[model samples]
Target chain A: MGKALAAAIGLASIAAAVTAPTAFGQPPPGAAACSGCHPASARVTSPVVRLAGLERDAIVRAMQGFRSGQRAGTVMDRIAKGFTDDEIQALAAWFAAQPKGGEEGNPARVPLPKGGEEGNPARVPLPKK
Target chain B: MTFTRRRFLGLAGCTALFPAPARGQGAGPRVVVVGGGFGGASCARALRQLDPRVSVTLVEASATFTACPFSNAVIGGLRELSAQQFTYARVAADGITLVPAMATAVDPAAKSVTLADGTRLPYDRLVLAPGIDIRWGALPGYDEAAAALMPHAWKAGEQTLLLRRQLEAMNDGGLVVIAAPANPFRCPPGPYERASLIAHYLKTKKPKSKLIVLDAKDAFSKQRLFQAAWAELYPGLLEWVPLSKGGAVTSVDAATRTLVTDFGKHQANVASVIPPQKAGRIAEAAGVTDRTGWCPIDPVTFESTLQRGIHVVGDAAIAGAMPKSAFAANSQAKSCAAAVVTLLAGGTPAAPKLINTCYSLVAPDYGISVAGVYAPSGGQLADVPGAGGVSPANAPRATRAAEAVLAEAWFHTITGEVFG
Candidate 1:
């Protein structure tokens, strides 16, 4: 029984890692930073330029331009000063991988406990608007 | 007690029906957030989004939230007060329990908050985002009574309306004085933006009227961009007096509509003396704030270093490099919510990355901004080495015009995200 429990724990750990690649099962690193201003996809209310679904290289180029002062931006140049080439690349890749409409808000931080998923009668559902 | 297949199956069914708690972890962790501003509201929503099992209750004193991000535009008459207002219908629909009551006290040991009516709401984790409260007497003779006469207009809502009315009622050539506070205030660039917007209003409506900024600090956020815009647009109409130039206002006589600075007493048709500020009273009551009058927290989790299981975000926390801006608060709230969810599941929190973009509208057609990306390192949030900056100095009209549109869009989208 003890050995079986250990094996289940090991598999669950791997599953969690596979399901949640980012730290803390939250949005990809740097996603929240863009959320408030750019969001994902495009909206009439969105002010900043959208980056989701953009080619990785294009995003990298814009970030590099801002970093090097070649790009004229409201606050991008200053903001770009905070990232390295590698971090910028990572951010670019993450955003590019996202769906056009953005991730469904943010994912659950931890996997649902056994028997507590959507269909579970015990689960407290969101209120209807 | 003997282990048998039939007995084991029966016990397993019982365990499945009533699951054991995760070691020492509590069952269905409840998170309570106080104050529904950018930080608290975002945290509450993110908490629900991050873990449906983790119950979230949001305690807000006001029925409707008034966003400070664009309240300056409202004060400048660029936008209406209604535009800055928002309801919590969406946030509630997202599964967070909305408690429309003021949190009067926090008991850390019990993990509960006593509301104004003395209802105790318990929680496994508490996020306090009670934003800045003005140090009313910090500016001499500037108390609640004086604020009624000379509106600070800092908190938005009624104060914003008061200032707007004062601006409209003033005569064409009357002088308007705006007394700006020192560093580490909410929206570091706000006073200057207000000045720019007020100047825009004056230029179009009352060109002869002049506005002066009596600043406590010698420097300001986005100084060069604002100065450049002021020079090109309303050159002589707007003037800024730095602290070294005797611009520091020491006191005000609201009855006489006069401000006393190091230089001398200056009278104006209207005055706005933005007072110095500190973390909201609830933070101190919760024992999260320290000698600096701001809460200190773990940079990654935003958990108050002073109190375990309690997190602080937004203007109240001494966020190392991040300014107390709405975007910063929203970003921190997301990260903090993640941390709370992780801890509730008996897991360690990972490092967090945050971003802040603050845009200031100098005119209806012009906007400028400062932005930065931050990460928790060396126990503090430090800006990424090469990631953020301000809008170019003396940029072309098109760029500023585009930024203006972006600023509006940002305001709309962020408010929607926070409230919708």
Candidate 2:
């Protein structure tokens, strides 16, 4: 089902790409919200797909597919329906400019503490049953 | 820069005769943010990212922030409390001055905040991300003292452990009761998620035990999905009572672990009463909250409608269509930060695009979600037509498993972005 939907949306994008206009400027109004789920860096291990550095056309196509119910998604379909074509184009342009991969020695990256490990004092011990 | 009389007059209920302190030559505008949860921390970082010139200071009472999102997993015995805790060490390293002190008062007329230790910090723009504070005594017999006996694990710290311990210590056939509150509460789906996880624990550890949810609301977020999951995954072990069926808890007796409704009184061996909530006390002291006990704000910029030069995000804000969730708070903080930056630069902020997506787990591998995309419409936030809804009912287990993975990923990515 997923493959068939992707192929169908692929064909639809080819036709839409011919008329799509390039959008650029300060990041559009809603662009920052996407990073809540889609990580900015490739090194961030997330099941949600990363959006940085993707082809603008690809982002536009995926959004259109989600909006039109041609693509299967848990939440993206609902979110995609909220954006207009212009807004999507603007967001696509902004995300395409970001780095697709993580910086090697980025001091900003902080490792998250692992959950459920035994013998770690920070982990709250389970009550004796 | 001179303080303008017009700006002074714009401040509501101001009686101060003194002017705001002048900045040094070529100094950037100063911004003060209170509370270091998802909202304030995100805004503090976003401000530095948007404009390096703005001098930002964050005032938080605690050295570490305990996130409420995954704290439920801790209560359910699936995760650890340490995983939900984060420090602002990296946030401070990102050019923000961290003031580790409690904000005791806010003088809007003077545009300064007074800390508990007699320190006053002034700012050109102030952001209050004070999350919800339980309205003790609103429901008779449910107060701070009662919380010690019947824990309300809503704030996600010691209370979380208290409730977890109670559940673990109960005998095999003990009855567990969760009293859920009415509308406009933080994490609309939280009580249900807690119920689901606790039910999972009871089923595994104490097969003879039973759990009951007495909800104040007749309907709830992700109702269809949650009810379906409960029926399938925990048939005889759990029961949910809605408002129409006498679920609204009017009062409680902590000493007896008894919850009273209009219809009858129910007693339990382990009780979790999530009392009614209001905007954090700091918001009230700041004079930004309305009669609804929540702060009203301009949907586009999240600036408090009741007080100029102050913005309120997170659970405290009266966001029209947005539920009080960590994801929504993070989104609002970023937008508010961008607007504050623009205003400081003497430019108009563009209309904001706000979004919220909340993921809840019924079991370790069974997850569900609800999402919405909102924009300012008719002077308030409204959901765009044809957009946003919950996960489909009766989905294949693979779909649920996939969402469960994504839910964990969401936690990692968001916490990393704000704190890491």
Candidate 3:
């Protein structure tokens, strides 16, 4: 039984290393922070728009707009001025490659436990006027 | 006690219930995370997500975590305590071992954590996200017992409800006093937000009551925005006393509900004295804390400067220029997780870029925020030039309402990420 357990553990480790999800590529330095406010999960309803699966050019254009004060945002303008053009390009490309469904996104989304909805106000839709 | 075929099958079935990939039950580097708040929980989950081969264990004292982000809303009667409460069922379901026991001691040399129940958890890396603990005797006449009479409500659970009940039970024309702490505390803008929400509660529920904020700092985060909203929404109801104006509370008399400042002593019907704070007790026990009572870390990796193999994140860490807010904590945790993964694989971790956005609601519909991008510089984290600042002063009402909605959204999205 002990030998069997050892073999199973060894096989699992090898499988994990071989199937590691680095195939999706690593995210840029500051890219993970964007999902703090922007919903990575389609299941999460928020006023902030999700950046996953956006056109790389579109994301770059919006960031440039915020940086140059051409676009108006409550917080994005301040945040955009922090990144260089190269960093922005890298982030845009990384986010654009993420799956829109959110499973294979920058900030990986996990399945909530049963009745976890009660703690997540974002899951509820905002009231319409 | 002999192993039978049926027994072997049952064992296999149990192992099948937890997939080996997610659980990292294979031979790999082990990580043990203490404290299940935004920092610790995010790190534990991020470690698993980053490399499923790494075994992760989260040791939290409580079954449920009460988040401090929206806890002020609870004190203002704008939210329920249940909305701020979350369980670790999802974190456990992700296959990390969840230990619901207080971590008592750390043997850094041995790389093991001793729990209150006498179980020792061995680990290759230890991440301490213990958050902040109130400095009990730092303020004269304010200790654990004094908290019963004059609640701080800083730590969020029972104290949050206590302060709310005090506000609810106060007389219609009563006075509410909030004593704000000095620099380098958890949530730089929290005291002001608490003051705003308490004023909102007073305006709607007890029209004749008044609130005064005794600030230990002359200026605070988003100061102009908060002051502007106070003038427009709560002109006569709320008053702010800056430190230069003798606003610093020197001591407290809980029984009499009196706050003594350098100028004079003021008695209030309800007193919320936010005392001095330091890193949580566990960090000190682990011998990672410095003279500042906070752990100093390598800004890029969050590895303790004083201790090897132990990383500190969240409010317990002295992250330069980054306010000790939940958003910053979560961001730091992710960076720490990434660095830990690389280090375990015998690779050098790259410099990390981090961000923090903190929203303060002046009213249920009026909100303001400060955002910043940060990177490692000069051996500490520094704000990226021209990248972050407070909300524009004198913005239109529509903008304020929009920010308020976004503030709620930020809360939901962040809490969902960390706890959901």
Candidate 4:
């Protein structure tokens, strides 16, 4: 094998070594509460739109859009589609209680609108394409 | 230029805030990092990036990292494996002594980690970011040999290739069965993406072929987005059997290449089973893992609560409120690296912030994702509420494809953070 290939293989074994037998930590207390409604942790924070200040009404609409093919992540969208209006609010309430994304957001850096502030209740009004 | 008294005072104030490792502590101390995937690589790279004086040794079992992040795209035919693969070339250039060895034993009390070849390396601190391993027998007849017959392809390398080959060679009307494992595995959206990609290929090449998903759970990550796209794009070509409908495969007889599920026995032209997983072996060997088969750590510093002088990240450590995704591993790894460096430097580690964004493609141009902000709290890191949520539903194809593009960029950004 070439030196590079040999080096690569060597690294793979070490990776295999570290991951010898573990998968992940146990789900937290509320994880089951969330999983019953959604499979994975649906609310993940990134440098994009903030999950804080999310309105239940808006969340429900978005979930409906996703479920109906007006949204994306077909899997998640469909799951959202199945939610009753009440469940959407529960999801919104659950995620809204979490903290804002740790990363700074520059919506203009890519696509979407400027994010909302902590108490400002910045609703991401559907983009006015 | 020589530092003036006034300038010296300004720099000194800053140093006091984030005190550098007391230099001439004789090349500081050595930090041995295991695993070259996102978590390990990020920790190793970050250690060197932040501290110029620390002597860092990174021992990895593989030379090339086939990232699970982009490997999904490769299976979708959007990219090749080479596009997702990386070498330690850049990390090695960063003044880190990259070792090609597997850590077989970790003597935390002695602060030394032993490799498979019996090479004992000592460290002031040891960082273990080992990923995961399949419970080979969790599903009956799913031993190492039998796995070859029905590839799990969970690791994102050869199995990915093998799974791809079988899919490519399958006939138009052939049946492709994807048996998804239970919760808490590597990459929540992974299995869904695999189904979507396979469907993409079938829709184009063999429109009549079937892509069937047998899921242990009724719901999966990004379910809405996946289903929406499937109905709109690959309708009648994809069928999902939930656990209630005998989706869970209890066992498989590789000799006959048949899968026996809770419902009944089924034969398919191709079968892929994602087995249940657990923390890597070394964590168990080091006594860091608990009875649950994963290492329990103080979520703040990601230090093993069960063992001193040892930190576990990635799929090995039980990190609450975070999906076992690549981004979470990288974030947790970076924070762990920071904390280890701080403690070794004789300073209190600062609060760490963990961030993650896991994107999944439902079809060739359709993608969705979930993002979150997390921080160590009390004794664990919990997800920030309303900070992030899954992708909106029924988005335009442009937006869906935009997610796919963004996922690739995020993959590049993270891998660069770890090993680039």
Candidate 5:
């Protein structure tokens, strides 16, 4: 019964996750919560483009750039390909409405298990000549 | 699974069972596709879109899909995991029979597949796109239990959510360790993408938190591209230990959260072990594992040489010069679908051209890729010269940024093609 219950819960979460509302169909508050890393603050001089100051239209335009091969050979094309037109707008709106440094919404990390370890490691063999 | 006009008729006969007739009409040949990731979804959907006569049934273990392709952006906070999801409804809406069941075994001789629930699904042509499977015990001390404590999150589902939750909940200044398996696995650039995204989160959310990558390969899929991005964009926050430096993890004690390496033992606050992979177990059980853990297929037909009537595509079938990528799987699925359709239409499979270009996002504006177009030569698929290859290592920064955007667009287009 315990195993069955656990499996039930596992399956339930699996279902919930697949249908999670925060990000799949529309950009939820979560998308807005990541602007601190690359905000387009006037003082912010990241070589990376900042999405914070961009409007919904611009962000969508940027994503579309990747899609039509205009922004050729870029990963943005791959990322942009993941959403529907409606969902893309939601993401753009959610992010565009935010100010620079608007980061939040990260949950706490579950402690690593006593036996949990890296699948493969590479930093230890004596350095090869 | 001999192709016949009668089999196609039977497929048409089942549509009467649906409330609404699918987008296509008539009985086509019978095609059973297992797994709904890029490959299964693509093959099944393509069969219907390319040729309406074929009856396509897709058996996916889950109703909804959490794509591995861009889950990294979810990790980075640049994109939501929801954006990386699709429903089997798209496949169903496209008139493919979408079955939510795990494919357990295949009887190639009988041309039938046994589902986990003991349903026997017979087919004229069986397409197995169950993706790659983790050889669990390949790394000692790591088992399913250990995964709970430290998630591999390789298959892309709730653990993806769980990993995201853990990343969220970790205290600022915390340490997150990512252990990447050696090459020839699903989504070659996934680990680096994960690290970059995770570091992006840590840099902002935790401030002092760090992302440590313990990689098993000598160098990564796009080492220079990733290194340049990490240095200029995420310096001091992301660190990588390559295989040459003892980054190859030999074993793990999930209970102890300790990883044993040739160098020594070190523990982390969080660990994700993506083990060495093989063709999904059904393929192995169906007699597909060669000296390598993958099946070598005739690129033209994607037929399993070891067995008749079964074709393996995606990460299961080995195609040279093609990384085991989502784009490759989707492309392979289309070719497989075309071949199956041609044979069903009372014709021989055509000599096919397969195309794939995988995008890895470093930042929203930064991306890199490897593109290839393949044709059969000397019993194997070879990249057509000047058609596809890795993005130039020394591309201008702006160009790299452009590729990142294109990568996202490609993801949208390809996934739409499959599950849209």
Candidate 6:
């Protein structure tokens, strides 16, 4: 179910990327509050997932689940219940507005040099052992 | 800088009396932050993230930030001290000026901070996140010299290493005692978690060993859940003595590893003496701390209620009901950053919703947690009704295991948010 939703969001994001150069308006001021847990848009290794470039509607729906206690969360349920509907909407729009892969304003998606010859010489893999 | 009386009139109540930067004379709002722990680092980064126009200078005494949240894991040998360590590289990379100096004094009226090296940093606003400093001499015989022998391990880094070393050196079937402090300490669940983790180490490594927790408080956060877990997972290995039962460690003789209480004295192969703490000395030096040894701040803006132009966050600030945890510090920092931005822009600060989630590992793969969402109510941060709770006591093992994963995840994510 999670994969299916991700695939659907992927398709929608591609379409939105092509049609609308921007996702929404300026990032919400309170959006930084979420940064304390979800650092940036980039995929983080921690269990607490990132929220940089998810679909606005999906983000809103997820927050609504947390708010209503329909979603099982370690901490988000309590945190979401504190926000008003409007604040959640603003948060969703702000996160969604960030460009996914690499964009000027998005701090999360700084591209890493692919490994092998393209990466730093110190980290370059040696010949096959 | 020019003393423009009229310009200061509009921001009378909020802004302190300082030479207002002449129009376009200076670049932007200059915010100077002290202490580079969760609170200071998060506030510095959030200020720049929220508003690029603001210039942030973070004054941290240490080069690397050692997180207290996961220090217990380090003590238990589950995690390395390196894992709990963080650098200011990310904050500096994010455009905040990282000042490696100890802040000695904060002059609110002049809006300047004096560092140890005699560097006076001027600021439009100052944010103080000086984490707790142990109130030496409060607990008789528990001083710096004693801490060297009976490590507190509360501040992380060297003390944590000292505790770990002591545990590793101790023999099997030995008695490990932890003297926990009274209420309003840095982390409410920390001492228990340390006891649990230490018990796990002793059980796995030294099966015959025993653990004792001598707590000053009668009860603790998540008492039922912790007690239940101990009975189930580490039965006969752990014991807890509350204050009513003569638990408080009134004094410590580090030379002999003996803790003296009103009832009697208890000796141990190894001991952890967590002394009472207060707001960092800088807060007191600045005259922000009151009789309670904590700085009072406006819940809405985190501006010092005792003095203007200075805001305190993290363990030092009296944040109403918020526990002094890394999560609370980071949350308060974000809100404080926003308030600084809004107030500097000549706008009224909006009410903020603060959140905190403190997770403790009872044993490896056994976790318990308490979460809360707070809002400004009657000039203090109050827990929103029906928005906070502790993990269920009788929950399934799977639930506890999942929470353990979340607990690990929370440590990494929060450290990244604050320092990364």
Arrange candidates by lDDT, highest first: which order? 3, 2, 1, 6, 4, 5
TM-scores of chain B, in order: 0.94, 0.95, 0.94, 0.92, 0.90, 0.95
TM, every model: 0.84, 0.88, 0.87, 0.73, 0.71, 0.85
Candidate 3 residue lDDT tens string, A4-51: 544543343243233332222446677778878887655566667889
Model 5: reference contacts kept, as a fraction: 0.01
Residue-by-residue lDDT tens digits, candidate 2, B167-264: 88889998999999999899999999999999999989998999999999999999999999999899999999999999999999988889999999
Residue B7, model 2: lDDT of 61
- Let me know the DockQ for model 6: 0.14
**Displacement of the residue B258 alpha carbon in candidate 6, Å:** 1.2
Superposed model 6: Cα runs more than 4 Å off: A1-30, A41-44, A101-129, B1-26
Report the lDDT tens digits of candidate 4 across residue range B230-260.
Answer: 8998899989889999999898887666888
Predictions in order: chain A TM-score: 0.54, 0.59, 0.59, 0.36, 0.46, 0.53
Ranking of models by DockQ: 2, 1, 3, 6, 5, 4
| TM (B chain), model 5 | 0.90
lDDT digits (tens) for residues B1-420 of candidate 5: 354535643553443333333433555457898888888887786688656756788988887777888877765666555667676654687788888888888887677889998999888788888788888788787777777777788877656766776676677777788889987887788898888888777777787877778889987777787898899889999889988999889988876567878998767766777778888888887776697889988876788777665788898888876778887787677678766665554444545555566678877777777655555655676654434446676778888777776665566555544554
List ranges where model 3 is wrong by over 4 Å: A1-25, A102-129, B1-25
Candidate 6 chain A lDDT trough over 10 residues, lowest sum: A120-129
**Model 6: residue A55 alpha-carbon error in angstroms:** 3.2
> Which regions in candidate 4 have their CA more than 4 angstroms from the true location?
A1-129, B1-26
Better of 1 and 4 by TM-score: 1
lDDT of 4 by residue, A25-71 (tens): 21111211222112121222233334444665676577667656677
**Model 3 lDDT per residue over B145-170, tens place:** 88987889988887887788778878
lDDT (C-alpha) at residue B140 in model 1: 93
Instruction: For all candidates in order, state the fraction of native interface contacts they contain.
Output: 0.45, 0.46, 0.41, 0.00, 0.01, 0.27
- Clash pairs of candidate 6? A41-A52
lDDT of 4 at B244: 90
Cα lDDT over the full model 2: 0.83
Could you give candidate 1's per-residue lDDT for residues B105-191 as a string of tens digits? 998877799999999998778999999998888899999888877888888877887788778878899898999998889999999
